[model samples]
Target: MNKTFKIYAVIFIVVMVILALLEVNKKEVTDWRKNFDTNEKSPFGLFIFDHEAKDLFKNKLKKIDQTPYNYYNTHKKESHNILVVETEVDTESWNKILDQVSNGSDAMLIVSQIPKEVSDSIGYYDSEISFADENVLKLTDKKYKNDFIKLDKFPSGRGFSYIKPQVEILGKTVEKNNSDQANFIKIKFGKGNIYVHCEPLFMTNYYLLKSGNIKYAQDVFSYLDDKETIWFVESNAKVSRFFMRFILSNPALKYAWWVLLGGLVLFVFFNAKRKQRIVPVIEPLKNTSVDFVKSIGNLYLQEGDFHDMMAKKAQYFLNKVRLDFLIDTQNLDDEFAKKLQLKTGKTIEMINEAINLIKKAQDPYAHVMKEDLARMNKLLDEILK
Candidate 1:
């Protein structure tokens, strides 16, 4: 029976190991970022730029894969149309973009969420999510006013607006009564212009595939047609973060990393034996109670103060009697003797002898001897027993 149980346990462990290896090697379905990148081929990717959009724009569209700061710093004072398709930008990137736009270059910023720096500078802010029952957009331009293009139900409202005195309202929608919510605005920065369009989803692969939705992307490009180069910037982060994400996204590598972590834990548990130096056993310093009492007794004996020694011994004995029997020792008379004898279950003669010796020791003129201390010690031992 014991052999059978051992065989079954080993079989279970072997099966588990096989299953883990199989799981680690299993293939996973393709997972795409679904971002508004011009290079991706996912359902939500903008692969059209790699194929049709670049061709339509005369192959002048350039993809800027680095951070905005790096790209702008490297291409300082260069004239180009910049297209940023992210919802938010850091303060540094935002300032650099503003500087570029102010330097006589056209820029089209398509976003759903607006950063605080840009919102304050452009006088535009984000509104609530827009859920239009109809899949159409009402264009503000008179040329496209009659043209209503199909749009997906955007997760958030493309509501970016500025004061009419400061910026131009180029596009709007009539989703609510008595008000036309602005979805696009054009701001004149310095010698150039910065166009802020809230509906970037219209450029996505899913929306572009919809019937008559490509026209929306076409109109967006129409604003940047004068420039020979159009820089398409993607969302950026630190290099280390990108590398970690790349590693974690691979199933095989992720599993191997987990296995390595498990091996490390086992190594630390089973084989992490380091030779340590021997620690010397330190005996605690000896208690000085006995030495202190001996020193005091020797001093009293050398001074010939036997009476004081006897008084101290008597006081210590009385204190023990007071504590053990809960009796007062202010007057160590017959009452104390009777109490001590009753509490200790000792003979009255023995209790009386101890008490009489204590009383005789109280006189300063009394000559206490070794025989008296011996008798007193014997009397205390008898009473304790």
Candidate 2:
């Protein structure tokens, strides 16, 4: 096989091997499909505490045991109170539900990490909550003057304060906006209320089992009391928002996507044919004697080396002429000289001069005078003519 084909074959084999290995590794993962969970799991496959928090919520609120939404819809005889915990709140589905609770007869309680984008879209008021004697403004237009509760000191040092249970906040509270101590917030919007925990780690399976934060988690959800709550365990809306922002912000990424699409188009355009390969016929090589002689003659002319080259040519022509014309070189003073004189109708002096010039011209180094070399070439040409 040719070198290119061998290299391509090796590369193809290696790529296939790598892909196979990756597929096997992917299959080895316990919960690969759960990678997209917003709160329950992170991108790196680590299960965040939010999943455990959801389970704890399910166990604590017996009414929402089967499904949070189902329980919310079915619990109509009593006060239609609902609770929602989410990583982000932006989807129209979530908004529609919130609107229903706010405008309808139900009272809703929502616990979530409200992304800034969603907060901005809904036009919520901004407020900051502070720790270590620092003041934090609330996001809502309406303000609440209250003492800050130290989260580190709660439930045997694992619990934090719930603040005033029902308050209005216009702007959203984010985990990044507040200090590490700023873990949770409670907001009242329209007729529904929201309780957001910035860091959901305390509610995770691992932390709940070990850190004794289960009591705090229970307290956070139990505020709904006997009210049915909808626990929407969905992916973070912010991730999608962030991705949209990135695509909109980076012109190069947009161009790169276009370039990739163009390449795919070209690939499809070129490889549409399904033709078979045809064997090529090889031809035999021929000798190049005539070509070599002509090339040498051209080289000699271009270099103006006529005196030296023509001496060789003249010698060859003289040998052939003598043989063909049946002239005897021996005794050239009589027989050969007379025959040469008759054949060319040239003077004996000129023929003799030609012979002497050919001998002298054979050696280029012997010709010191430029005029002698020129005369020699002229005489040789005349003899050949």
**Leading candidate by TM-score:** 1
lDDT of each: 0.69, 0.47
Cα lDDT tens digits, model 1, 1-385, are 3454455557757986887777677675543454766656555566665467676567777766676777677876576787778634578888888888788887888777766777777664545454444445556778776655565444344575435577788776565432567777888888678887776666777767777776766766777756566555654332332325676778998898889867755554444354357999999999999999899878877897666667777888878777877889998787677777768988888888888888878777777887887788678767766
lDDT of 1 at 339: 71
Give Cα distance to truth, residue 312, candidate 1, Å: 75
In candidate 2, which residue ranges exceed 4 Å CA deviation? 1-3, 22-83, 103-183, 187-192, 235-385
**In candidate 2, residue 288 scores what lDDT?**
96
Whole-model alpha-carbon lDDT for candidate 2: 0.47
lDDT of 2 at 231: 48
TM per model? 0.55, 0.36
The top-ranked prediction according to lDDT is 1
Off-target runs (Cα >4 Å) in candidate 1 are 1-34, 124-126, 132-135, 176-179, 235-385
Q: How many clashing residue pairs are found in candidate 1?
A: 1
Candidate 1: Cα lDDT at 368: 83
lDDT for model 1, please. Answer: 0.69
